[model samples]
Structure formats: C-alpha cells, structure tokens
Target: MTPEFAYFLKVNVAFVLLYAFYRLFFYRDTFFKLRRTTLLAFFGVALLYPLMNIQDWIREQEPMVEVIQMYSAILPETTITPDNVPETDWHGLLLSGVSYLYWGGVLALLLRFLVQLSSILLLARKSKVMQIYDTRVHVLDRPAGPFSFFRLIFLHPGSHSDKEIDEILTHEGTHVSQWHSIDVIICELICIVCWVNPFVWLLKREVRHNLEYLADDTVLESGYDSRSYQYHLLGLSHTNKSATSLSNSFNMLHLKNRISMMNKKRSHGIGRAKYLIFIPIVGGLLIFSNIDAVARITDELVESSFAEALMPEAIQLPIQLFPAVNKEEPAEMHRGYVLSKEELAAIKRAEEQVFTVVEKMPEYPGGQKALLKYLASSVKYPESAMRNGVEGRVSCSFIVRKNGSITDAEVIRGVDPALNAEALRIINAMPEWSPGEQRGKAVNVKYTVPVSFRLANKHKASVSGTPAKGIDTSGRIFTVVERMPEFPGGQYSLLRYLSQKIKYPVIAQENGIQGRVSCSFVIGADGALSDVKVIRGVDPSLDAEAVRVIKSMPKWKPGVQNNMAVAVKYTVPVTFRLQ
Candidate 1:
C-alpha cells in the first residue's frame, strides 16, 4: 500500500478499536467530564499514533544494509522493444474508477458539510439578533435550532413561552461556556476524511450524545429542579425538527438516554481507575501499527525456540550433498560417516549464524565517508555493459563474517550480467570491516549494496544557476552510510509530506513540461538539510521549486557510521506531473 492509504487504514483500525472500548466501559458511566475527555482523546490518538515511530523505544529491527542507491539521469536511455506489446490491464482501469468513486463520495460529503454550515449562517442573516434577558441569541422566524454553533445559539423564541425560552438558553449556555461546539467540529472533520468507516460515524454520535449529557447535567445543577428540567427536555424533543447537523441541538436524538443519564446516580470515584487503561490501550496500538517490525522480532524468537531446537547443537553434513547408497544397504549408511562430537561442535562454532540486526553494525575501515570515496574511486564501469547501453542499479549482498572478512558475495537483484559481475567483484575485493555484535559476541551480519551504472550524459551543470552550499568539495559529505538520514516519521511520512507540500510550478504546468528532477543535498551531523542542488533538471522553474520545498523540510535524524553522527549526501527525485 502507498503511505497515505496505509496511514488511513491504521487510523481507522485504531479508532474502531478505541471507540469499541469506549462503548463497552466508559459509555454507561456518569463521569461526564472524564467521558468527554476520553472521547476527544480517541480522535486525537486515532490520527496521531499511526504517525509515531516507537521502534527505537521498543526494539530496532532494521538490518543495516550498505546502500549506494543513486546515479540516475546521467545514464543514456536504453530502449529494447519486445516483438509483441502486452495488452492493457482492466484491473488498473477498475482501480482508477474506484479511486474516482471514493473521491466523489468525499467531495459530496464536503459539499453537504458546507451546506449545513451555510444553512446556519443563512439563519443568522435572516434572524433578529437581540439579548433575551442576559444571553445573546439569534431568534429565527422559522422553527430552527434550540441549538448552538460555536457560541451562536439559534432559537425560535416565538414558539416558546418565557419559561421554555429560559430553559433552552440555560441548556445551551453550558455548551457555549464549556466550548462543546469544538468537539462537534472535531468529530465532523474526522467523519469527512474517513467517510466510509461506520465506526467513525457511530463515534460521532457518541460525542454529540456525551455533549448533551453534559449540558443536561449542568442545567440540573444550576438551581433548576430535575423534574421540571426533564419535563422541559421532553416537551422540546418531539417538536424540534430544524436541528442543524453541525450544531449541538437541544432536542437532539437519543433523548431517552440523556434523561436516563441525568437520573442515573453519580459514579463512584473508584471508576476513575478505568481511565488509566487507555495508556496500555494506546501502547498496544502503537506496537501493532508497526507490526511488520514486530514480526521480525518474533521471527527471531521462533527460530531460536523451535527451529534451533530441532537442529543438533553441532552441524555435521556428509562430504557429498547426495549420498551414494544401494537399495539393499541399511538406511544408517546414508546418514553419513559420522564425525566425533568435538569435531562436530568445532564445526558448529566455526559456522555461527548470520544476523540481520545487532546491537551495533559493522563499520568500514575509517567511516562511511571513506567507504563512499573508496567505492567511487574503485568501481569501473564495465566495457560490455557500456557498449550495450545497459545501465541500472545492481543490488548485491554479502556476509561480513565474525572474523570481519567479506565472504559469500553475490548479486541478489541485478540488471545485466556484466553489471552484476562488476558489482560483486567490487564487494569481494573490499577489505575487512569491523564486525557487528549482539550481546557483546561478534556475529556474522549481512549487507546489501546497490551499485548504479548510469552513463554520464550531456546535462553537465544544474539548470537553476544557483549553486548548492557545502558541495562535496572536501570529501566530508557521504552518499552511502550504514544508516541514511530519516525524516521524523520515516519514508511513508516523508513521501506524504512531499506530495502535499510540493506544488507544481505555474509556469511549468502552463508550458506542459513534466519530468522527474533529481535533487541532492547534505544532511548535516545535526540533521539539518543543506546544499540542495538539482542533479539533473527538467526546467529552471521546476528545479527551483523542488529545491525550495526540500529546503523547507524539517530536520532529520542524522546518518550514523561507526556509532557516530555524520553528514550524508542524499538524493530525492521530485516529479511534477500534470494530470
């Protein structure tokens, strides 16, 4: 899933679980103030918790991979056409239709929301504004809200006697004084974004209901007889038909429950303890939302508990993978010529397992800065690959053994055989690295490095004449590191933020120019971004805009090498496509 949709799912799932808990425990309680707080909290957490990265506080599971993931656009385009073109997929067409349909629903609901707001405002324009005793209200000529929007109370005063008017204003005064309308606004906004989630709508109902319960309680407490207030509410319930969707209506739905809550005895102080349960509830949501990371941790445990249990402490395999035996011979003959226990144990110790993550990652001879320079100076573009115009990233993986030697080098994913061979050749030739450790014991750790072979093109300099600050002049800036700089919320958040913040330039849009512009920048040891320059540009307008938005990004967590913060050079490809 794309980041936005993933976050949307996380938010909805979290809200559904939280609201379900609210309905079960806190819904029936008489702690009106606390329930109000709890209801509002669900909305806050449902949105914010998914954006949080708690893996560091939990446990880090990311395998340290030596990433060398740039060198694009400089390559000449290599096009190889197949004999026959494939047919178009109707699945894509169907998905496109579904996307349009979902957005149409959103647009329709937003219009409805606007209409409701305007309906209340239209009432204000038509009604007479006056002070009825001490409270300010908009008294409509037509039957409308004994309701409020923000602090503006709308009432059809002509329909009620002096006593009913007094009660209506008194009930609404609690809503205005306590700012209950804010809660209504918050719920409505959530409903719009997640229009399809039924639980969100139900949660909206609960919020409005809780607000009414609060308003009713306040009216009863302020020197009004409970019997008389209940009668006043009952009278208003069946007759008030012009309630606005965006308002806290006095004669709102669920009148029976509101009255029951009023008559219900005050809850015990001990019930407040239930509120503390939210801490764990939110904690679980945080953990589960990043379940991919958690699964890695679980897999590690399972391998130890079950898979390791089944395997012998010593690993002794026959010299040949396929043992030679006759059908008449005993099955034990195929089990192999067994080695002594000490020899088998020694072999097991020699072949200790490789880990994906550890307390500390393996380091290069000097640091990431030296590693990048070494690879850059050493890697030679293959003559065969260049002749065929084959240029793409060759993803290679290898093991850094406990003895700190590079071994088992091979290509995991590759473009051309020549390119693959060169990627592996360079990795195998790498000197010994500082081995990674888990619980103070040196262990084998795997690393993935992708070497790019983009042919240098004619676009030599940046189109935007503005030079980048702190360019890689002194070789202090690094392009590859054990851990690259991360924006606060990781890749998903970074993508979402860029998609929202970067606007297509008016000039570029009008001219119908759209292509990807690769921008490179330095993320300082302090995590501040600097030296943003276009590596390859489509247009000056596009290049400048890409730089502007990137420079506006928040500080990142600096890249680390050898357990120390370092400035790392990074590239982001921004596409300004007009649809």
Candidate 2:
C-alpha cells in the first residue's frame, strides 16, 4: 500500500480505539449529555482534522513528497508496471500485513484493560460501603461502594471537628463522583500508545493534572471551607499504590499545585470569558493540525530551499541553445550470424563472388585516390573541434553482383549525414568493380570496409591546430554525440525545429568553434529530464544552445546506479568552423 494510505489507516484505527475508550469511560455521565456530546464532537474533529487537511500539509512540506517517494520506491509493491512485465514477490505484502497486526494487537490489549477496570469498579460498588468513625474519620475497608472504589483516604483521627469531616468527605467525594480513576487509567493507555512521541506523553501528563483540577473544583463547589480542605489534603499525604488499570487511593504527586489551585480566588465574572476562550483556541488547533495545511506549508518551504541550493553563487548566462536530440533508433536490421558449417561456406562463396564482381569495375574520374582526395579537401574542422579535437571513422557495406556491378552501397558507421552523403555519392558514381566467383560462377556477395579519419600533423599545422595523440577516440566522443539519435526524422529535423524556436542559425562545420557545454540535470527516477542547467559554458550562445536542446529532448531511460534509475550529468559539444 502507499505510505499515505498506510498513514490514513493507522490514524483511523487510533481514532476508533480512542472513541471506544471515551464511550466506555468518560462518556458514562448521561445526566449532562450535552457536555458529553460536545467533548465527543471536539475529539471527532481533532481526529479527522489531520486527514481532511492532509493535502495542504503535504503542500506545506513539499520536500516530504520526495522523501516519501524515495521511501516508496524502495518498497516492492510500489513496482507497478504494465501487464506485460513480471509481478513483484509477496514478501512486501506479508510484511505490511504483519505491521498492521502488531498495532492491532496493542489496541486490543488497551481495550481489554479498560473493560477489566470497569468490571472491578462494578465489583467494588456491590461489595464495599463507606462508614463514618466517630465523625472524626471515615474509613472504607475494601470499600464495597463504587464511590470508595480503589481508594483508602485516611480521615484525621485527632480532628474530630464536624467541619474537618465535611472537608474530608468533600475531598474524597470529589474523587469518587468525578470518576477520576477512569481518567488515570485512560491517561496510562495514552502514554503506552504514544511512547515514542514526547509531546503525546506530555499531553497525557497534562490530562492527569486536569483531572485533579476537575475533582478539586467539585470539592470547593460543595460549600466547604476551601482553606481547611487544603490543610486536610496536605495532612493526607500517603502515596497511592500504583495500579496499571485503576486509580490509586492517594496520589502525592501534584499536591502543591492542587492546594494552590484550591486557594486561588476565581470571580464568577470571568467564567463566561474563560469558556469563550476555549472556542477560538480549540478551533485554531483543529485548523492548524489539519494535514493538508501542514503539508502545503512544508512543500513550499522545502521547494524554495532546494531551488536556492541548486543555484550557483556566480551568475553565468549560456552562450547558445542546443535542441533536444532524439534518442537513437534501434538497428532496423542486424546481419544474422552464420551458425552452421553450411552457412559459413555459403557466406564465403558469396564473398568470393562479390569480390570478383567488384574487381571488374572501371576506375572513376579520380580513381580510389580521387574519392580520398575529395574527402580530405571537403571536410572542414570547427574551432571547437580544434580545441576539443575531432576524428571520424567510416564503415561501408556493399553488395557486389555476379556481373561485377556494385549494388546497395550503405555507410554503416562513422560517417555523419553530410560526410556520408558525399561518400555515397562518389561511390555510386563509380563504375562497377570485378565481382567474386564461387565454383567459377559469379554470385552476389556483401563486404564491409572501415575507413579511419585522423588529423595528420601537417593537416593540424595548416589549420593552426595542435594534434592530440593517444586519445581514445572510438566510442568516447561518438557515444556522447550519438547518445540520442534521430527520431522519425534525421538530425536535421531536430535542427530545423530548434532553429525556428531559438531564431539562431545553428551550423555544423569542421573547424574554429572552440569550447564545451556541461549541463547538470535530473533524469527523474522515472527517467524524465528536469531542472537542466549549464554548469560551465565557454560562451553564452553555446551554453543556451546546449540547454535548449537538453530541455526539448524526450524523456530518457534514466541511468542506473546500483540497479536504480538515478540522475546523471551529460556533456555535449557543438563545433563550428570553416572547411
């Protein structure tokens, strides 16, 4: 399941559990049904507030999406693919199920404890009863009454005064009447569930304090001397026995606060205002805790921060805009391998027959040397090519017919469109060569020829270029340049689109355009290019050219690092010069 879905499920379960507890414990007082309803309504809102506004919360924390996405990608079930692809294993699904089970078990135990405590209270109510001893002390030994439920508050034996007994009755009575035991038990459960969240634990502690305040308010309202009641509370200082599911008889904790609160004077005039304050505070909390709001705030903050970090300290504009180059087309046809001896023999016979056919062709106007001479003179080196340098290799494939005629000559490799077209033109213009023969009979055969283009020392000298030696030229420069080949149309198709868009004449030449364009871009985990930037550009025009091209290109199958698609850096060159 998605992380968001999982989170939703978890929170809903928590809310259900909390509601069940509230119904079983806090909502027992049907006399003040409206108060109970109001409390329930507040809790209901609190529980759903986070979910209803989850989108805003996500937007607020924009970076969280990346973090969550990163996490989601690592999970196995997230691998949603086409029906043609293989399905993922069930291990991830099982693990998720197990996590849900564990949390469910915890919630079950909490409910069970609350039920047991309620059972105990019922038992106490049936079996025990409160007694007044000489009016100086009221003792309930194993109180049969629910009012003295789990408590054993000591009445001052020396103070036999009726006022003191009243104070004792009012204080202990407040604890029983308000069902403080239920609050204590519920608070313990809250601590258990939210043990990892410090804020939640703090809230549980506050709930306990509030329960005490609620009981104290009851005691004072019963028409007792609040000061003497405070002294009575101080004198009764024995610590209560800690019970997992029930409130203890005596609690020494918060004694000072309770006594101080009892003494504080409250004007009846402020009651209305105090109640009014709760409306806005609670409403605001509900709004602020809204998941969508929080998410939105987080998203904006993170996106702005991330964008700022990516910007370079120094401002440098790009020189030129390069059009997005389309990816290479798969080889339309691959020459099949000869697997058997018969196949090999047949191939050999064909080669011989074709060679014989080629041998008989007439020499061209400049012969073989003439074609080479033309290539040497026509190819111009660009300035950028001079700086970064350029070398070309040509591979040609041809079929020689039985009559010694060259047929279907194709430039298989190395030759660029302009160069390849020129080479094919010259080859096509030539007379047929002597064809090969098999068993003294001419047969068609195919052959491949590789031609290397190197910058000779003299050629470099003429162009005022320094020869670069020992550089591994094969695959390095060609692979980067040819990384993405033409789509439906050839390179010119892309070039034409870019020219119109950028309004710049982008020419491909052989000699003085000097420099390199390096761009850092994100190939999204999904393999879409985004946030392209020219890290270093020699000239503004060239830089802009590179960025424009990159931005226009279609999505890539992102590079893989450790079997995962990752963002990568690419550098391409655009060389321009005179031939």
Candidate 3:
C-alpha cells in the first residue's frame, strides 16, 4: 500500500476507536472544555502517528537466530515449471483510476474549502464592524446570524434583543478567546484529504458539536440565566440554520442534545481515565504499520533453514555381510541395507537437478511492481542508441534457482544490440527472488520479463512547423528515424570528421579543460542546422568550440518522421583533451 493511502486508513481507524471511546465514556460528561481539547488532540495524533517508523521496536522483539548454513546433501530436490502468468494490466489501471479519483476528491474538497474561506472573508468586508473593547463585532445588516471566525465575530445586530446580543457575544467571545476556529479549520482540512473515510466526517461533526457545547457552557458560566439562554438559543434556531464549515458558529444542529447535555449532572474527574484506552490502541497501530517488514525478515530466516548434519552421515550404519553363495544359488537378503557409492551419488544428483515445475512460483522482492521500479531506475540508455533514437521493447528470460539466485539470463526478443545489452545488465543486477516451491520444497524456476526503452518527453523548440493547436499530432521529435540525420558520410565517419576537422580551443588547452560538451540542435526539413546551442558546457572555451565545429560541419541527410522530412532535434557530446 502507498504511504498516502495507508495514512488515510490509519487515521480513520484511530478516529473510529477514539470517537467511539468518547461517545461511550465522556460524550455526556459536563467537562465540555476537556472534551473539545481531547477531540483536537485525537486529530493531531492521527495525522502524525502514520509518519512514525517503529520497525526497530518490532525487530527488537523478534526472536534472533544464528546464521543458517544450507547443506545441499540434507535437502531433497524438487521440480519446478514456469507458469505463463501474464502481467495484469487491469490491476495497474484500477490502481491508477483509484489514485485519480482520490486526488479528484481532494481537489474538489480543497476548492470547496477555499470557496468557504472566500465567502467568510467576503462577509467580513460587507458587514460593518463596531469595536467593543478588544473585540471586533461585525454587524451583518441582514439575517446572516452570529458566528466567530478567528478573533472577529459576525452577528445580525438588528435581529437580536440586548440580552440575546450579550449572550451571543459571551458565547462567540469564548470561541475566539479559546481559538476554537483553529480546531474547525483543522478538522475541515483533515476531512478534505480523508473524505473517503466516513468516520472522518463523523469526527468532524463531533468536534463542531463539542465546540458548540463548550461555547454554550461558557455563556451560562458567566452568570447568564440558564433558562433565558436556552430560550434564546431556541428562538434563533430557525434563523441560524447554516454557517461556514471552517468557523465557529453561535448556532448549530443538535440543539436538543445540547440542552440535554447542559441539564445532565457533571461527571467526576475519574471519568478522564477512559482516555487510557488510547495507549494500547496507538501501540497496536504502530505494530500493524511495521508488521510487513518484520514478516519479510522472518520469511527470509525460515526459508534459509538447513539440517545441522549431512543426510548421508545421519543415515549411515555398519553393514553385516552374508556368506558368499555360488553363482547358481540365490543371494540371501541382508537385514540392514546399504547403498553403493555410485548409487548414493546418483540419488544426490537426482535430488539436486533443477526442476521444470513447482507448486509455487518464484516472486521478486516487493512483487512485480518493485521489480519494475528497480529496472526503470537502474537501466541507462546507451549513448549510441540514444543519439540514433533507437526505441523498442526488450524481452528477457532468466532462471531463479532454488537458492533464490538469478542466473542464465538471455534476451529472447531484442531491439538494438546496444539496447539488448543494457536490458540484460539490468536483469543481472536484480536482487534474488523467493525461490519457487514444489511440494513444500524450494526449486528452480524460469521467469521472463519485458523492459522498454524510450526517449524522454520532448519539449518544442522555438522553430515553427508545430502542428496546429486543435489537431492531434505526435509533437515529439524523432529519436530513431528511417534516415537518420548524418554528417558528410555515415555515423562512423561523423566521429572521424569531428576528430580531424575540429580544432581544440587554445584557451581550453591552456587551462587543461578536458571534458565532453553536449550540444543540441534541430535539423530542419531542408537538412539545415537551426537552433544550434550547447546543452551542457564544460568550460566557456570548450562549449564555444563544440558549437562552432558543429556549425561549420556539413549535414547530408535529415530525419524522416511519418514519411515526411521534419525538424528533428538531436544532441551530441564533443570531447576536448589536452593532447
């Protein structure tokens, strides 16, 4: 699983357990402030817990064993056959589709978040503000209701009585003073990234509700009449139906629950002990996240097991000989049996022969995806092939032996010879696989894989002839072409022409500048070099000399793309030496 997707899962699991605990033990308790803090803390932990690495802790608890030595004599031989399992294209497509959908959800939610924030800012500007002491009271002339965004409070001044206004201010003031908007924004952000998890939405709702409960309690604690505040909340409920998601609103849903919670008796401090459940819950998540690595280590140790003593020595016993019999007489059978050296050797050879079929196929470390990733990263395009734009797929097959070592790799289908060699080099560098199994014994298996070599995405040069914007076209320059752009003669002659016709710069020779300077240019449809410039420079003198030589040289042919001469860009490196 990707770390990003894993993180989302971990957070949701943490939220489910943490939220469930809250509902069960502390949801109805009168510790409104504590509840708010605890909810925010839960979110903070969920976000950070996934990034922590605890593999070391897990490894420390694993049983350690001395290095095992495999004895060929003790192991029974097994047969293995390569299964032609085609790589699943749909699995890749599904994963890519899911990734796109996830990002789409994130983008949509982010856009919504920004729009909500914009609306809140717009509201602040439209409403008139009156400074009362240290607070800025934004009076919405219309019936937008009361809410707090950061330190600014928005309220419809004309819609509320003086007593109601006083209570609203105290409630929203607590939201601002306690920085409750931070919690709302935090939850909204988390919900945006983890919207796939229903528990995230539930957690956000719980947080917003807890914040409202805290604000309501703050008003009552500041000497407001409980019945009066409750009645005022009911009176405004109809008008205050909607509010910005990333702000603290004076009114929210669940007024009935809020009233009930207020009337309920306060629980003792001992109820906080319920939070202790997090200790084990978090510990379990850490173990789960790091378990895959530990399991891989354990599999390695188990797969390497070998019997301590050789099988021949363990089974060998003193043989008793029977009396010699005449040729005509039948030989008496011995009680104990022993094999001749030749027979024993033959049995050992049979046990060790590479099998053609196996019960379980060999697997690359981290599966096929990881193997592909390694190949993509490790393979380098041959310089000769790159200059000529040689591109195609290379299919190679190799043996994964019983000991998990890769061997006997050969390219079955190849493009250019240079490309084939590069492909083989990468396969040879692959790490060992989990060897194939047959009847619970490890065996050799053959595996085939395909690797493709292609040019990097090309960028358009300033020159014209680009396809019109509306028309679909292959805008990429040709790396390989029917007739490659050439110097006076052929590819081999181009190297000779550069060596004999070119002059090393005097300043470069004096300064001991000795490196290759890479230059790129477009061969126009008319077989003329345009946009000639040094792409990589060793020194100023060397770079100018490389460009000058290429400009002075004659071009005989132009690359053909789509059966027509096109402006194909090319890059070549020129070397400079003191000699």
Best by lDDT: 1
What value of lDDT does candidate 3 attain over all alpha carbons? Answer: 0.64
Query: Ranking by TM-score, best first?
Result: 1, 3, 2
- Candidate 2 — number of clashing residue pairs? 92
lDDT of 1 by residue, 1-579 (tens): 345876888999987899889988898999989999999999999999878865444432323110112222332222223347576767679979988988898999889889988988887788899999788998877875488888799888887889888888888998999999899889988898899899999999999999999888888888788988888777777775555688888888777998889889999999999999999999888876655333333322222211101011111111110011111211110111111111111112254766755667677788554665556656676766555545555666677788899987877656789878877887888999999888998988875554545443321122212112222223466655554576764443565566677777788778867655667899988789998888767789888888998999999877766556778877665555555
Tens digit of lDDT per residue, candidate 3, span 280-371?
Answer: 87777666655543333332222222111211111111111111121122111111111111111111233466543345768789864465
What is the C-alpha local distance difference test score of each model?
Answer: 0.68, 0.44, 0.64
**Cα TM-score of candidate 3:** 0.49
Misplaced by over 4 Å in model 2 are 1-42, 50-119, 122-126, 130-139, 142-165, 175-196, 221-223, 242-245, 248-252, 265-579
Which scores better on TM-score, 1 or 3?
1
lDDT of 2 by residue, 1-579 (tens): 444554444444444544444444433232222333344453445445555533334333534434332332222211224566577758779878876876786687678767767765554455334466432223334322112333533433243366655555665566665666655565566545544444444445545555566566676777767777777666655523333335434344668877766566553443333334436644444444443333332222222111111111111111110111211221111121101111112234433533312222333244444533443444343334343434344455566666657777888664355445544665565566655555565667664434333333444455535222122212211112212222223223434444444322243222223333445565554446677776545456666766886788776544433333444443322321112
**Using TM-score as the measure, which candidate wins?**
1
The predictions' CA RMSDs to the true structure, in order, are 24.7, 24.4, 27.0
Clashing pairs in 1: none
In model 3, the runs with Cα more than 4 Å from the true position are: 62-88, 132-134, 296-579
